[model samples]
Target: MALAETILRAVHKHDLVPKLTRALPWISLLFSFASVIWLLMLPIDGNYRKSYISENALMPGQVTSYFRESEWNIVRGYRNELKIFEGAAIDERNAVVEGWLKDIGLKTAYHRLHDPSVQDNMYAILHAARGDDTEAMVLSVPWTTSDGEYNLGGASLAVALARYFNRMSIWSKNIIIVFSEDGHKSLRSWVEAYHTSLDTTAGSIEAAIVLEYGGDSDYFEYYEMHYEGLNGQLPNLDLLNTANLVSYHENIHISIQQTEGEKLTRNDYLTRLKTFLKGIVSLTLAGIVTPSNGCESFSGWQIQAFTIKVKGTSGGNDITQIGRVVDETFRSVNNLLEKFHQSFFFYLMLGPRYFVSIGTYLPSAALIAASFALSSLSCMLNSGFTIPHFLLNISSVLKFFVMIELSSFLLSTFLPYLVKQTTDESDKISLVNLILLSMTSLVNINSKFAFSMISFSLFFIAMVIVALLILNFSLALCIGLLAMPLQFVQQLLNSIEAKIKVFLCLFVSNPFFVVYITGGLYLEAFGYQNGTLNLMTGLLTSWDDVQCWTWFIVMLGWFPAWLSIAISCGLGDFKNQAPVSYIKKNQ
Candidate 1:
């Protein structure tokens, strides 16, 4: 409270409207930081809910399944056939597969898509059960890339499933078998084409089940379900629930991990970790190449993306069993009457079991980002009217904008070379270091520290005025932002401390230090014991009262924190300034 009074008085003494005026910068910084934190916290995990019939008429998982027995020999024969003709030319493979589908008495037609992004061919179709191909569910099996590789057993199983599906007359929805080329990238494009109104050239598709590898006899340690959809849009809550239910019902020992989850199997972990590193590498090289030549974004499918083949493992579950999982899953999706609308479009999962919704975690990252933006805005507002300094500030802002423009330009140029350099193992550190250096250079060059301080101070004052809002949000956010300046002060002193011992002593003694350390332990308790973190996740799934209130507070609180900080710093000279000193001197 004393600190608040001191800050207000300092702002008031300045020629600028003091008092709460100082709080403006602080508030702005807080809001900007919160926004950035929100973006970063967006969930990227692949766990999707199972699709269910939203409309009353659509009954899913209801049909008496004929797939229980008597089909083991046929499934094995199909699996064996897959090994012999694997990765053969798509046309040759298609001919044989089409013959099999026709023999099973299903009407099939080929849908071709030409993807210009990676230059590949994709083959897909609708398997009409009775006659009319009105509503359809997609069963996608990516064909081999240009290279002759027989690794994607998931695609082979999908093909066999298509043949099996053709024989069944019970399917109410038409099953479209899509043989996507160029891997996941091409599949994304084709699926986009199918759904988009502007790009409706690919025709309409209902729900889609992407089959990755499922042909080998060797069992996987556990069935891995990849659900992180493009851009964080999940399938449906019911879909995820159904998959979990079905996985259990089948008595198949399986553990699921979304693409970014924590409890990942060793192989899954290594595979994704490698992909992340490679992505970073590609981006770094892309940055360098963009300035000199035109470039394109690199594909993980083309690089060290994880490839789990069915032929390698011998223990978990058989090819036939995997086929049934996909079949049952599709049957569940076939029941969907409406598009996915309930679940969150964006989320981050720590593991398959642990997840954070966009709402809760978003604030953490968004707060960070909002802090930057608030600092920038406060910087702009406090920009000294002094002619030379104002001009200097303007020049700096312009220069930073120019750098951003140049980076964008570079990104468009020399993309291929950047991708190659990234994929090359030998060039790792050089690329990573360069990227970091560039980003840091850009951020530092653009930082308006003096103005930012003034902004932070002003925002802090404003927050005090509205103390009533303190209880509206998770206290964690309020405390975090309020302590930012203290954190800054401690860091600054720590940097200049004379000795290691002195620095450690000052750190422990600092006012902010005790709060942070104590708060951290308490936060851990909330996360582990109370389901506090998961409660946030649940809130994010639906637009409930808590999420609405949380968003409001985060948005409102951020700016004030930044503005107050800035204002506080701008008034730093107030302690020595005297009012009406000229009159006193004359007397």
Candidate 2:
């Protein structure tokens, strides 16, 4: 008791950390700069490690593959057969595919989802000849991509593989071949149904591979392997590593999202930087907004999945090599003693061969979040470190936060449905931009409320980013970078130029605007048609079908927190410091 009294008296008599408190802003700036520099360092050779196989039981590319010229005619035959049903009804196409599966002497099944989409699922089971049916693998081929491109090459290859698997007897787990109507949506529904609703299941699924080439006989340049799963989830690194090594073994080039320059070249600084940025963007938006690649449907089921698509036309490699890659890859996974384990589940790939581990890249996001936390604490200290800040006008502050949040909530609830009412591609984004722009209100603020809300909101952002860092590092870092200036916005409101700077920050940081700009850049990066409506469509479907909370957080949490801070800072009266000084003295 005597010791505690002495410390309290010392604290009350003298302010020991005033200098430290004043240095918080500079410290935060330095930390932010250092964090950004750390991320930029990833493109350097030493900052990343070459990816390797983690599971020794599964040795990739060790076995000789017999999937060469023998199966070429069969694949072409199926590809030719699919041309008749190019624009046919869903049932018609499914019937044709199911007929081919039945002809291959396999147990075929018909699954029709009772939805208005009128889409159906066609699958066949190739029971393992040498082992009991205790575990299984999936070879899923979506009839058409979510963007509405029919996957003729992929389906033909899948059918050819089904026929080839029936001829071999080295299989351990049963192989289930699936052809879904919709690339992602119907595949997800069918996978869910296969586990929970269907009476016929091959047993627990161990792994899945999705084929997504659009042309059957054409020579391709490189393989684009997509590993991101729903909700920003990633497959075990071993699975990706297996496929990557096997592709190299077959003399095939490979790449991932947004990293398409000179394929298989990671030596140049610009190549590495572009690869890092593109990969980060793709992984950051995984699940909720990023374009679906059909492999994500198998996530959350303890099943490792990836989509392999052959792109470009300049290369000499043909479907035969792709077949061998798939065949050897399957043989590798088939040797797994148990499910995938002992490999990284969270990692960033510089390319197929190189990767930056969670340890190397995670610190960048952690530092940014720490800066926010530090700024929040500094604001609290300025207000005399009150718990709930009783000096704040509780009634007014409550109304302010509630009002701003309610507006965001209302938009989140209805905007998706509202966009569906219009079919115009331009109008879809226009609606969002208009609604958010209208939601903007430039009004005066209470200094006490500004400080308190900034204190709370900054802390909230830091916590949110910390949580997101575990789930999606790119998202956490993106939000942190966007809101970096927010902590000090309140202090710089004294001048007109400062106010304009704040407005510019708010303008660029708007999530809707960010989506529009980034969405365009992503489309333009690849030769994809410019349409953000797909992103909106994906967000809506993910929210309704998969119950993704990313949309909700963006709506009710992210936007509201940002808008409240912007409103508080935009018109806040900082010239009069009397209120804060009075509260400090009295407290």
Candidate 3:
């Protein structure tokens, strides 16, 4: 025991904690670069694998789909009936849909939006006779989608399916058919009311399938699964895989949002990479910048929902194939004993059949965010790792962060209302940009100890971005990647030749330029508009429509971080500043 104690003491004598602490800064710096490389690898072919069923119970397309010729005639009849109400008022259209639901022998309900962002909605619930009334599934069909396409065929298909589902006794869960105007708006309100009000209750919805078909049903270019929900939330991968598998069994070609689900070729790496990037963009902008299908209304409710867009202009596919996909997919879900828990909830898709799970992609952002923590630790360690003293040193910088956040709050809150008074919202945004520049200039006035302030700011922003990364990958990662250079940028600021590069970096990453120039570049890169006007317009629209946090994230999150970097750079040299330093005592 004495010999063991001596050996333990000997091991303790060769302490490596100091070396590790000394290595923290370099490790943190290296991690930022490593994250960039990691992110780049995600788009490569071998980085992601083909998606398969993760849940053994989810036997997709194993059952027969009976939504064929007989119910199809009912689909046509309802389609014709809806055509009659094309130009009618919203209330009148809803009344007609409700009456049809009652005639079909189902319990129907109606909901009117208080704000009138969209029109009212009509829904029917078919309670299962074979099982207890505890859980349900939803089939939503919009009169006109947010995409501005008339979903007549989709609506009719829903009504027919409702009628067909009501007749079947095999259902173990209630089936709900919803008809809402403007796809997302009314459906969102209805879902809120459904969970909140007794009148709208139809058990707890476990899953939903939104039908978004439009144009002639004689042909379609492709079928798309609109799965992205509000704030970048996605339904379980099993649900997506089930839908894809069911579609395959029906001989239906399912296309992902960015690319067609064709067999991967040796030369299709560009297409795959583009799909990966586009998927990231969509996830990043989910609630704020991206338009929603009705399925998005079910987000955050634990109700896995996705939209089926049977798209076409003039092609050689029938719309009946969509009904079959929905039929078998729902049948698979109905067989589930409980909610989805086996497969991934967060993922990036390369194609309908390919995906990169959270495990594969999380490290990229995690490393970037983690770097700031290490940097903060290194700074604290330099001051003897006293928490109280570290907090005291960073207190003023925290206040400065608060001040910048206050400025952001003002900009985000007032800008939306103020933009309404302007002929163009961009003018207001430009004015805000100038105000931010003026505020940044004020922050640039040399503080007593800017290094500590910058370090604390880095830590705080890292905390914020880490939180945001959970909510929206695109927004958080973009801020993190941009913030990564600040550590290196501060060192280079003392050199005259580096100032030009510094200014260039700051100029391009400027909040306004990010919104205009970088935004335009992003849009153009993804085959969107080649100009900045649309980007600005999208921001305004998102603010007005859904109160999306693009503006808040820019002002509170990205802009403040940029200001800290700028002020640190502008401060020039840290050598002359007298900060309380750590001195290792003689042992």
Candidate models: Cα lDDT each: 0.42, 0.76, 0.72
Number of the top TM-score candidate: 2
lDDT string for model 3 (39-153, tens) is 7788776888798988888788778888887666788888888888777887787788778888888998777567745776788888888768889999988878645767878
Checking candidate 3 for backbone clashes, the offending pairs are: none
Clashes of each: 101, 0, 0
Tell me the deviation in Å of residue 386 in model 1: 7.0
Candidate 3 ranges beyond 4 A from true positions: 1-29, 43-47, 261-268, 314-316, 373-393, 417-444, 469-471, 485-488, 524-554, 567-587
Instruction: Give the Å shift of residue 458 in candidate 1.
Output: 17
lDDT of 2 by residue, 413-491 (tens): 7766765565555576677778756655445566666777776677778888889987878778887887787767544
Off-target runs (Cα >4 Å) in candidate 2 are 1-16, 146-148, 261-263, 289-291, 381-407, 420-445, 578-587
Greater TM-score among 2 and 3 belongs to 2
Worst 10 residues of 3 by lDDT: 578-587
Kindly report the root-mean-square deviation of model 1 from the true structure over all alpha carbons: 13.8
Best by lDDT: 2
